[model samples]
Target: MFFTNPLDNKLRKWGKAKQELPASVSAMKEKVLASVKPKAEPLPKTKNRTPYWFVLSGALAALVLFIGQYTLRQINTPVADSGFGIASQEQMALSSKYEEENLASDMVTPNVTPSDLGIQYGEATGLGGRSYEDSMVEKVSNFISTGQDRNGAISDAREFLKYDYSATIKTRKVEQISSRVQTIVRGHGGRVDNMYVQEKHGYVYFVVPKSSLEAFKNEIKGLVNVRFYTESVRAQNLLPEKVIIEKSTETAKESLASLEGELAILTKEHNTRISDLQKQLNGVVASINRLRNEVTTSTVRQEEIKRDISRLSAVQQKLQRQITDENQNYNSQKFYLDDRIKNAKSEISNLAEQDQNLQDNVETVQGSVEVEWVSIFEIIKLYVPYYWAWVLSFCAIALAVNYFSKRRTIEAL
Candidate 1:
């Protein structure tokens, strides 16, 4: 093809511009230029370089977000047995058993409160207080309240305590018997609880401390010729009922303690203020006594009044009889005299009624000196005749005789 001058000039201008390209341009591009020159635009790079801090910040932000998301999802998630499962997790769970939370102990684990559990947890197990029963009653109560049934235990205890101890020795004086008993008891570390020495009969009662009961009994067998031994000691686990009753009694004692305090205050006041009142009362009492002296014996004030009324009636009748028998001017005089006697007796009777009421008031107040006693009676063995007593005695005697005969008869022979 023929090249025009203008086209040749344009080509030379483009070649100079390409010649300005970097020397690193390859021989390959030169060969491509020889084959067919192509027109194409090259992409440009930023004149300013990117900063290291921006790239580092973007990477750090992405890492932090990934960690936060992982942590959020982990919360409230069920425990698993992965690398981060419960086995590897640094956590422990508390026991959730209701018994462990409530019972507070493993032994005698209470299943329910006493109200729901019946008598075991009832108010009967409450604290104790004082009582008005005598010492004997108090001791028995204490023994039973731990767990023993009341009536049954007391009956059992009484049966065990009953020992018809009847032994007659050659000792002339009561002192010798007492001395011998003391020596035997003390030697075995036992002590006598009670002894009675009277004009008619002497008796001794002692307790061998429970720990020594068996030992003491055994020693006694070797020491004495046990004529009649009917004492028993039994172990008993008292029921809760006794303890409940005892505790109730203790509460009663607490109440009584408050009452006794009030009584003490009253007594003090009586000593101070009521003492003066007592003087007035004593004067009233003295007047009452003097009036009572005016009355007859074998009668209360009411009875006295009746007796005097009868006597007055009898005397008046006799006087009337005498006057009627005389039957003279005495009949006119009798009317005046009989009327006077009737009026005097009527006044005395009215006075007696007043004195009776006063005596009653005094008697009503007299209970301050009176004490209350629970009536206890000896149960007479009425069903058993003297023959039974003799049998019991003869049995005891025969045993003693047989033992003595075997032991002593040989010596005598």
Candidate 2:
């Protein structure tokens, strides 16, 4: 028999095998080579070129157009026109008119003019209604100094008023006293030009005629308790002083006019500012309304979102409950299945053990049966030779018994 070495045969087979590239690899190599090779066709070239001057001209034109448009826009821009100037002018006119009316209404015409006070183009008088010359002569005669003359005394006396009286009365019943004083002043053809009445005290400013002043004082003295009183009498002309006062009054009136004009201007400015502020307030109100609407919309959306969230939360809670129930059921089923599996495994193990035991018993019984069969075969083989001998003996005994029986039967017959 030929025995070839396996290692040598394998080496020979490996050496005889042909080394060749796959068809797909060869085809891919050919494709790569074809792609790497340069093509024979020539690339096309443009014949025309745009001039730099044309590009530059287009850019310049665009810039000019942009500048022109910008200039147009600047020229077309509207100048804002505000009504504040006009409104302020109108308000100033109104304020000036109102101030003039108020000034006219508030000004009180004087009842006692400079002439009534013996201060204007009049002869000076004494407290007793004496003429200025007579009063001066009497005063010079009574109390003239050594160097002073009658004319000098008279001039000195004429520079001051002859009499000016003011008094304050105190009383427990101010209201009643004030009323009586008013009545007496009125009855005496005098006027209570100014009066202040309070719970504890009263002030009565009586403007009595020069002739009735003494009578008015006496009447008031009878009506109320007099806390203090004074009377003054001095010669006065007051003409030059009145002239200075009139000049000062004129200056004050001029200042008041200037102040009124300035006040009108200020009021006009204030009204203009108020108008602007009113416009701003109206815009603010509009914005507030818009914001309020937005807030209302947001509130509605918020409510809707809240309801949606609530519904989603409820759904989530329900789903969570279902998941919990499912998890519980799954756990219960898992436990039941686990127990069933364990029981099945235990039963299978027990069955396997029983089956092994049965197999062992069957093997033991088969071995015993085989041993018994072999012993039975041996016994049968051992009895096989004696079986014929025993049969022969049985046949001899049967023949002898048959002969004897036949002989006996014959004898009996």
Candidate 3:
């Protein structure tokens, strides 16, 4: 198709008006045309192969996000120790003792009948029809069996065995899980002893009824994934220590009773001695008064009576001094008794506290739960392994849009 220039139309209109250009104008037009050579073709736009800084920035951001997510996830991973504070060696030994006792109970053979042993009753040189060792083993087995069967309930072994439970969880909703843990504990008629909640982590220590521990554990399981959860149950046999405490407490009580009895006896003796001394002193005073009266009324034996008065007066002073000394001695004895009594009472109180602690351990199950917070990015990475691919795709699209937009703008200009 042929195209007409707009300048051509204007020139035709000028010519139809019969307008004649001067020679100088014609010459100038020729010069102008010569000067205005055909517009140099725009240098072909070289393909802009510049690196997309924005895309690179996006990639760097994605890498940083990946690293951060990985770090967060690692932080949430449960430690090998489960972070449940370590138990003492003694406690660990006691825990192992329970297991050993259970195994021994299972291995224990039933008492061999006297008839099976071809020994009649009372023929084994004992009141019972069994050997002493067999009898002792039977009793121990029964005790062990009773302990295991109680399942942390009230029983003979309850006073001697302590139970504890610990668990840890990792989740994105740390605060929510912490609350749920407390709710579960309370629902089981348990009480929270300690709790710490924060944006990224939480800890809850609780004591639940031993009878409800299993149920509480079940509820805790619901709040965590198996992969992100850890748990431990420990049973420590406090029998030996408890027996020692009991013996000490009994001894202390006996000592206290003995001290009280001594104090009572000392008080009675002190009162009786003081009364006797006062009576003798009163008699001496009466005698001295009588002697003085005689000296005044009877002139014949006045000198003898005076001597008798003097002797009575001496006795009176001696009695008074003896009473004073007796009082001091009694006070010293009383102070000694009081100190002894105080010490005994204090010892008893301490032992009682220890016994009470043991009882509480047996009656309740201590539990702890640690909640580790997870970031949203970490959660996404956890659920989607190829999250970085999505980031890369986004960057690629942005780069393409930016490049095409610049191309369009340049073509328009």
Root-mean-square deviation of every model: 52.0, 77.5, 43.8
Evaluated with TM-score, which candidate comes out highest? 3
Give model 3 RMSD, 1 decimal: 43.8
Q: Would you list the C-alpha lDDT of every candidate in the order shown?
A: 0.45, 0.50, 0.77
**lDDT of model 3 at residue 340?**
98
> Residue 273 deviation, candidate 3, in Å?
2.9
As for candidate 3, its clashing pairs are: none
**Residues 4-113, model 2: lDDT tens digits:** 66778877877878666777998899888888867788868777788999999999999999999787554333211131111222433454455445543333222334
TM-score for each candidate, following the candidate numbering: 0.19, 0.20, 0.49
Q: What value of lDDT does candidate 3 attain over all alpha carbons? A: 0.77
- Candidate 3, residues 1-413, lDDT tens digits: the string is 12565878877987888777776998898888899768787999889775899789989999999999787555443333454332333544454555557644543443455565534544565554256656544545565565544333345453455787887787888999999999999999999999999998899999999888888898898887665665767776766557668778999999999999999999999999999999999999988877766525556688788788888888899999999999999999999999999999999999999989888778888889988876666557656667889999999999999999999999999
Leading candidate by lDDT: 3
Candidate ranking under TM-score, highest first, comes to 3, 2, 1
List candidate 3 stretches off by more than 4 Å: 1-158, 169-178, 191-203, 224-230, 295-298, 371-413
Q: Quote the positional error of residue 138 for candidate 1 in Å.
A: 32
